[model samples]
Target chain A: SQQGEEDPQALSIQEGENATMNCSYKTSINNLQWYRQNSGRGLVHLILIRSNEREKHSGRLRVTLDTSKKSSSLLITASRAADTASYFCATVDRAGYSTLTFGKGTMLLVSP
Target chain B: EPEVTQTPSHQVTQMGQEVILRCVPISNHLYFYWYRQILGQKVEFLVSFYNNEISEKSEIFDDQFSVERPDGSNFTLKIRSTKLEDSAMYFCASSEALRETQYFGPGTRLLVL
Candidate 1:
């Protein structure tokens, strides 16, 4: 079963604009990570925020996790045309096994 | 930087035919995993491998599915029989440890006719 469900199934923005994507999950999670996937390509790990950590940043990427809400959000600052891709949020549950459950993903189109 | 790699960017097989997907994870990584994404669907976990054994697998991984680390550098996922419903993009990933950030391969697009 899919754990995370990203909001704004699709987002269109212009280059240099900011793009934000939200993900909501149902169960308790050990951690949450965000990834980018170009069309027909593999996923690229962006950033990960542990349950204990409220927020994390890497380069132009920012990720925040709220355990109380069982949700996380990814923010791309100063987005570029190259940043146009599908963004997905993956969660690892605090359960018997360590497995990642990914969301349907948000398709962001950054027009140049 | 080292990245995971997979062979046969694309594979086409007929229903009931067997197929094997190969992967070479980044050296020094202790954990490996397999995932599949059907077109227009979320990426789904198949199984996780560690210490030469399967640590976990999803219900999608049935008796017809198996995983093997044939050599120090090679990991393979075999399907006993392909089905039309099996068509999807299969990806291989590796991480330093369980629940850690994972690096994914380019993925092999499988088409079952």
Candidate 2:
């Protein structure tokens, strides 16, 4: 069974627009991490938010976590054509197992 | 910055044939993992290795699947008998700490016929 479930399986927006993707998980987690993958490439870590932390930002990326709702959101500000790719959310269970369970992912298309 | 590397960016093999996918994780990383993504599907965790032992694995990782750190830098995943359904892009990832960010390799796209 999958631990994380991403909403808006597919999204499309023009360049410079803001893109938001949400993920919901089932169990308690130690941390949640967002990753980006270009076609035929490996996943690159974007930002990670620990259970104790509410929000984090890196460059054009903003991540927010709400433990009470067991959900997280990734926002890309002023998106560009280069940002087109599949975005995934992985959750590390609170048990500290160290294994990450990934969601189905949301495919974002940024038009130039 | 150091990144994980995988060999044979693409491989084509016959069903029932054994295949070994290789990966070279970051030199200083302490944990290694293997995950597979079927075409048009989510990334699925296969197994995680740490301290020279299997720390955790998913149901997809059965008796036919095995992992080894043959040397200080190389980590490998071997499948005894490949099935057509096993066709997918296999990714290798490593982390310096237990729950830290994991750096991923380019991935080996395996096609089993």
Tell me how candidate 1 scores on lDDT: 0.94
What value does the lDDT take at residue A82 in candidate 2?
98
Candidate 2 displacement at residue B25 in angstroms: 0.4
Tens-digit lDDT string for candidate 1 (A1-112)? 4589998999999999999999999998989989999998999999989899999999998888999999899999999999999999999998846688999999999999
**lDDT per residue (tens digit) for residues B37-112 in model 1:** 9999999999999999999999999998999999899999999999999999999999998889899999999999
TM-score between predicted and true chain B, model 1: 0.98
Error of 1 at B79 (Å): 0.6
Cα deviation of A33, candidate 2, in Å: 0.5
iRMS of candidate 1, one decimal?
A: 0.8
Residue B30 lDDT (model 1): 92
What is the lDDT, from 0 to 100, of the residue A18 in candidate 1?
96
Candidate 1: stretches off by over 4 Å:
none
TM-score of each prediction: 0.98, 0.98
Q: What interface RMSD does every candidate have?
A: 0.8, 0.7
Which regions of candidate 2 deviate over 4 angstroms? none
Model 2 Cα lDDT, one tens digit per residue, A12-103: 99999999999999899999999999986899999889999999999999999999999999999999999999999999999868888899
In model 2, residue pairs whose N, Cα or C atoms come closer than 3 Å (at least 3 residues apart or on different chains), thus clashing, are: none
